[model samples]
Target: MNKSSGPDKNRMDVKKLVSIGIAFTLFFIAQGNILTVTDGGYSPSPKLCSTLKLVPILSLLCVVILVFVLIKMLKHKYVHFKNRELDSKTGSNGLSSMQKDNERKRPAGAKNKTIGMGTDVIKLFQQMKDDISEENTLTLGYRHLLDLACEHLDFSAGVIFIIDHNGCISLRGYSGIIPNSQENYTLELKGIVSELFERNMPRFIRDINSIPGNCQELFYGFKAAWLLPLMPQGFPVGLLIFFHKDVPKHREEYYPKLDFVNIAACWFYENHRNNRIVACENRKIEMLIKTSLAISSSLSLDDVCRILVSDIGKSFGCSYSYLLLSRGRQKEMYVQQCYSERKTPVFEPEEKIIDIENMTWLKEIIAFETPVLLGSEEIKGYPQKDKDILKISGSAGVLIAPLKHNKRLVGILVLVEQRSAERARMGKEVLDLCTALIAQASAAIENARLYSSLSDKVAQLTTMVNVGKALNSDLTLLSFFERVLDGISRNFKIQNCAILLRDFEKDELYVVSVIGHYQEDALNKRFKIGKEGITGRAAALKKTINVDDVSKDDMFIPSTGNTGSEMAIPVILNGEVVGVLDVESEDKYAFSKREEILLSSLMNQVAVAMEKIKLKQLDKERANKLSLTNTLVKKLSGTLDQSDLLANAV
Candidate 1:
């Protein structure tokens, strides 16, 4: 019977005994060999034998020490190898488990089970992390992710559906054999996808017959089904659908793992969506920068408008876009520039100008300080004129961005989207993002408008200076008036212009000077004051009158039928109306207030010239009479005769 010693103690004892035996064997062999080689069987002396005995004992002791050292070294190596094996099997938790085992003895089977489950969970997480980390997984869609989940969970078929913020669900990926149909093209808000998302939980179905009719075909020949909602944010953005041919034996144990997969899938899906959103936002920002550049490219309002319409139309995917500018505090606006994706015009040339008073929708848009987005149903409630315009433009949805500056509404940007089953309606996010863009555009447009107005003022001043020079120069009264007409026709960019002088004694206005394509009879045309043409009205009222559309103005009597717009200003001298300056254009609304002011200033120069000519004629007549009187007196004195004097007097 051996006393119980630990493995190390027992091994040390065994090595000691073995080393003693080997030492004894080696000593005997050395002695026997020496005896055989010694003087042929000669008897040894007592001293020699004693020496031999002592040497053998010394040799045996040395051999036992060496062998014991070697055995100890080998034992240390074996212990180290066993420690490494234990560490490998138990991982970092080995020491802790040992402590726990000493504290309270538990069944080894339970401990092994716990460790195995933990290892499996770690491996599952690691595998999912590796799969999602791949770059292609994001771009190629999440089909691989679904496939991984199916493979791990032993599911036969699986599908994934992603939901947007608008409650719109779309099929992201599908694996395994699943029936397809037109109804499955896109999952609507009221379908199983929505139901699963709203439930926000994992559901396990034992029977396949319990599924909805439309979705039952998808899991045909399947015995069991499972649904998992991917709700990383407490609200579901995705759903996972899986079908099994046979019920899993470890279904209970698989739940937590399945939930983990759900979480991982959700994380991957959200990251993918977030990346796309960021990309989309980046594109929108780039568009805004480009639009700002376009607006800053020019100071001309027309050029700015043209660039804006095109950029906005293309960027926002609009079917038609119009840049409508207000008429300076008036409830009126006109399309400064328009764009059509279909290469068709939205409004005719004559219909470019719009009266906001008649269109309630325009007025509403002008009243708001921000952009407004309207759907087709909401647009139906707008005014008839607005509806007609939208219909003609083929607009199913409308986005109106108010362009405001200095706290005043300068204009509105109208973006029209056509109806299409494949296209998506504009979202509110568009309006939110566009708010800043609209604000920047408004400031730029305001600056452009100011630049345009200043240019017009400078031009008007130049025309006034030129007209004054032409009227004051050494030209006859008739030539001076002709020069006035010519200056006006050129400076104002009008095709038709005339000067009409009122006959004080006849109470009639007659054309004095004319330019442009006037009828042959226009030169002598006459109108009764206070009752006839635009000129007569200006003369009678002694004020300026502007008609945007001559065809709509009853007071407009045309000298040439080509005139579509007309402006008349009275020419006054010493507070009395003496004549009228009439300007006309072939395009409707062609005459603006600036033109009226310019023409009026030119007419003042005309009045001054008339007065100067009248005074000059009077002075000449006086000089001629005086000269005749002097001649008569000289003749009478030379004649020294009463008859001669009397004839001169007569």
Candidate 2:
């Protein structure tokens, strides 16, 4: 080949041509021993053979060159072999045991068949990471994932085991028929099972019955189990185990598909562990919100308890929840209002409940001043005759939390589990959440009760002063009625109100005082007892009347705006009905039992005031009658001095 033979070619070409030409020449040159040189005769002058070197020098030089060439060739072979191996292994599953010609030679990290993770799984993992770092509401991130596993793996139940405060990792959810399954399926941190938890990787047991060591406890009922470690930020929080349906033989071909499930389950478990932390933190923030709202929005103990318990359940995913109060060191807790999904309270005690100090369950929770989680076994041992009587009631699990306010335990919060393990599993996270919620709820309950007691005292004093003021507010019929109406209306906004006076001789009810929008009609109408309208019915029957829905009332008149509720009162003077006072509301059922009592008292006052005015009228009429009688007597005597008599009479 024609090549550029300048300075670059000169060094390399000279070395290559000399070595190759001499190597072949040495192969052809074979000679026998000749004459002596420097000893006694003619000498050949000690020069190298063919200007290369002396025989001894040449042999040594050729050996050195050959070693160099061999080392270089070996190095080249090693580099190529290593590159091929690396190429095969970069992203592929296992080392290819196939033919050399069939060996893959793609670049390192190139797409390979064993690559299962794509953009979807990567994005999902990224989202899981974000959820770990931030706040989240749902702690069970793999709830939906478990559903997928159920569909794909053909298994019924699965569970995630986490270390508790006591360093015990217990089984939560399970599937299949197993003997004493509830009792035996548990993970202890210090023992054999927990050693695997520390390892934090995928551990598969193909046949549990044939394991090397004493795995009879864990694998007793289980035939095949796959336990995958859930690494939250690369640290093991727990292990997830899935038991196969019936039994299965571990096949190599099944490993690939099983590997996919393991990868997915691992990611979900990681997300769930992170979410548990995030969920707890979010609940803490929610507790702050509920605490602030419970204090500021209202001091209603009932309303505060409602808000507190709801916030707690939302944060903690507690099973059964309630707020309890002891009320001044009574030792026994009074269950105020339990938060649950019930239309009405399932249990309503007619009398206050008393707590037994000697109760085994209450000993540590109440006296020791520590929260407790009574496991399924403890709950089963609890002797509950009352529950037996209920027939369908059982204490699923008990989370006994003390309620503290102003550094004092005023109450006990009992969270009772309602749903089964299929729906939710109660864990240590739930208990911690309840403790925090109780702390916030107790503060609110204490404050609200104090506020209510104070408010009751102030209201009692105010009513005494206002009733006397009502008696002297006005004198005339309409003016006095307006003052009375104003007092009642101060607390309630009514659409229309009227005063009706019974004209007994004519047997008619006269509309005297009216307020609100339908002033024209209320002023226009007059009725006798037993008339068609609601007001007349009250007068006819002589009873206080309350109508919840005016729409249902057959004689309800459509007034200005919409009328929804109505009320009427009978005014009794001298133990006989003299008039009626009627009130109407646009609000449906605006008047409650308390309002009904107060309004009746106002009507009684109106009767007394009106009766006082009637007596004064009677006294004036009697005096006029006596004056006319005197004039009649003067005329009847028939006296001759009529002018003098008329002057006397005047």
Candidate 3:
């Protein structure tokens, strides 16, 4: 049995060995076959075949080594791949953790950046506030504010507009590259500006195309614009506008600064408003002071009027300024003094008279003692002549301020061709100022008139006193008449004056003394009472006669061809017309009221002196008759005897 087991184990070993040998053999055969195929089955010697058989074995060994090397490469590749995957997972986890950390820190970083930006904005505001605080004038303040805003906000252009109470807008200040059309931008409140003013809201326009077509022209060349209303005490006073030439990328960044911008705008508005008020008040005070000084400096009405017109033209920037004095019983206003800017046409003819009787507005102005503003639109209501005058003068508007004194209209102060917007802005203020000025001017004018009248009256009284003294110094009637005529001509500034004496016996009026024109021939010229000229008429009617234009009067007897005006005042004494004093001039209406009173007063003294002379002459004549009769009676007694004379008389 041991021998049989041993044999079986040996058989098993032999079979495993046989399997190995067979596999080896098969591999060699295959390799030989491959070699044969590769070598194209080329035969060689037996010795070469034997050497070639070792080639197959060597080839099999090389293939086995190559396979082993390939397996090792695959294992290395798989290990490398697995390690790479593990590394990828670890890297992904690290990245996630880093991302979470970053997310947590982001809010803090953002907060810090926001605080820094806010600080920068505050610093900018403080800088701007410091910059504009030094300005005192409204115009300068506006300029500074606009300039600073443009510089700080990267704006291309800016403008500030002030709206008056009358809904008129004026360009107050501007900065950078303003359009030429906007240089004199003045208009009534209208359009987008007006709408903004009415609504009192801020408007930010990112797209200019969004603007209305009608107002787009105002924002030409601008890509974005902001219009901020300047409201003080809830009243729209002005607008602050900024223009951007380019669209900003981060517009939100600027949104936070809008509040800062608004604060700056409010600062500008308050400062400008205060400055304007101060300036206006200062101007008013200065004007009042200057006017008062002028009024007090002179008693000459002409000088006062000149100062007033000059001041008005300078202060109000009027094209023409003038004063018109009321004249004649017709209440006509005559141009007294005038001042005009360069090349401005005269509004009214020099010394032209404007009748207030037909001008209801003028009458209202005088009656109410207020100013009347007349624009070209309202000028149609004026008289044709006045309308023509205003048109010729190129007046856009005329402000008429009445000069009233003691409840009477003394004169009018007219300012012509004021700018319409400026007029709307300052009309009431100017009117108030002018009203005060007119009050002072009226008083001055009235005082001057009184002074002139008093001076004339005093001179006339002096002349009459001198004449009376001379007449009472035993002067003859003819000498007295000549002296009276000379005094009338010299004192009354009359060129033609005559004294006509009544001849009661002849029932005629005879010129006793004549001063101007055919003086010698006029002397002692007689006219039938109640049938002849002005002197005769005066005597017949026992009243004074004044003809403004003798050419138009049928009763005027031309003493001279140049006599356009004449006055005949009757001298009455003891209830009867004694004589007439006649005066004439080449100028129509030359006899003023003062002259009439002077002549009347002079005639009164003359009449009294003449009456006394007539009485003295009558007494002398009676004495002469008595003496002649006595002498004749004595001569008759001497020649024949008292008895014979008595018998003849009986």
Q: Which candidate is the best by lDDT?
A: 1
Model 3 residue pairs with clashes: none
Candidate 1: residue pairs that collide: none
What is each predicted model's overall lDDT from 0 to 1?
0.69, 0.58, 0.67
Which residue pairs clash in candidate 2? 48-53, 320-415, 320-416, 332-355
Residue range 1-650, candidate 3, lDDT tens digits:
12222234345655775698689767766666423443566543345456676887878876775576566556545644653564353222111221223223322332222223644565676666667667764556778878877887677888777765345566667788554542445434556666765665556777765533333456678888877667655567677777888876655444434444555556656665666667667767887786777656645566777777887777777777777887755366677777887756464332355666666756766677777766555655567765554332345567888877888777888887745432333355566667666677777778777766776887788778877686567677778888888877777678988888889999899887787885456765788888888888889888888877787777777776688789999998987998899999988767756677778888888899887777767877899888878877877967777776766455
Q: Give one digit per residue, the lDDT tens place, for model 1 in 1-650.
A: 22222355456777787898789767755666323344676444444565577787788886887687667667656654654574464232123222232223322232223233554565665577557756443424467766777777678888776664445455657778654633433355554545655656567778765643345566678888787767765666666778888887655554545555665675566666676577558857886786677556656777777777787677667788888888875577778889998989788766877776776656667677888877655666666666775343335578888888887887788888875412534555566666767888787788788878787777677766765676456566677778777766675667888888888899999888898888999987999998998888888888999887888878787778788888889999999999888888888778776677767876776688788876766777899889889988899768888887878766
Least accurate stretch of 10 residues (summed lDDT) in model 3?
A: 91-100
Error of 3 at 561 (Å): 14
Candidate 1 displacement at residue 283 in angstroms: 5.7
TM-score of each: 0.58, 0.47, 0.54
RMSD of 1: 15.7
Error of 2 at 310 (Å): 3.9
lDDT value for model 1: 0.69
